[model samples]
Target: MERNAVEERVAQHYAGGIYAPDRAPEDMAIQSDTLFMFLMGEAGQREDMEAWMVRMAEAMDRIQELMDVLEARAEEKEESGAA
Candidate 1:
């Protein structure tokens, strides 16, 4: 499906009252056993472990960049009283 269509579908599903958007994320650290299993599953996916590490690093970097952009926009709005 196209990106817009997929987004619209997700919005519709959210509007249908399935998920609670106000839910808070848990602030919990990973346990050793869970970490070990996650690492093993990632390693099992590929011949080289570096590939998995690189993919995870890239995803983290993208998330950080998005957060920075949002923060900057929020600061701008606060300064300008645009909102």
Candidate 2:
């Protein structure tokens, strides 16, 4: 699938609230991957594959952002000798 189409789907999914905020990023990634694999095994279409890829990418981005925030906080704490 084209990158634009994948991006559009990602935006739509985000706007549609397809992702649950309370779920952990790791769980989202795992569930997305598993669903994609299952769909592929069942002969999924290009759109299905693209949507799953977009979901996984978004989840990974969120995970990375969380890690960056955690790392920054850790650095701050270390510098201040708080923990």
Candidate 3:
């Protein structure tokens, strides 16, 4: 799917509460750490590890971008409320 489509899908999912915003940062941090550990552990066992890592890195970058957008929006809301 295209990037915009993927983003839309994720937004819809988030709006539906498929993922809770309050715990998202901690959950994502733990999940990322787990994925890294698993990838590293499998690196010695898999011949295609390099290709897999490259794909995962690209996906992670996209996820990070989405998180940054969400964080900025949240901060804006907080700031507006404070003001």
lDDT of 3 by residue, 5-79 (tens): 323333244436343233432466536656433443344334464555576587789989999999999999998
lDDT of 1: 0.50
Instruction: Give the candidates in order of TM-score, highest first.
Output: 2, 1, 3
* Clash counts for the predictions, in order: 0, 0, 0
* Model 2: pairs clashing at backbone N, Cα or C within 3 Å: none
Off by over 4 Å in 2: 1-47
Candidate 1 residue-wise lDDT, 1-83, digit = tens = 12233233332344363322322223133133354334434544545546766765886898899999999999999999998
- State, as a TM-score between 0 and 1, how close model 1 is to the true structure: 0.43
Task: List pairs with backbone clashes in candidate 3.
Answer: none
- What's the TM-score of each model vs. the native? 0.43, 0.45, 0.42
Ranking by lDDT: 2, 3, 1
Score each candidate by Cα lDDT. Answer: 0.50, 0.53, 0.51
lDDT of 2 at 62: 86
Q: Which stretches of candidate 3 lie over 4 Å from their true place?
A: 1-47
**Candidate 1 error regions (>4 Å):** 1-45
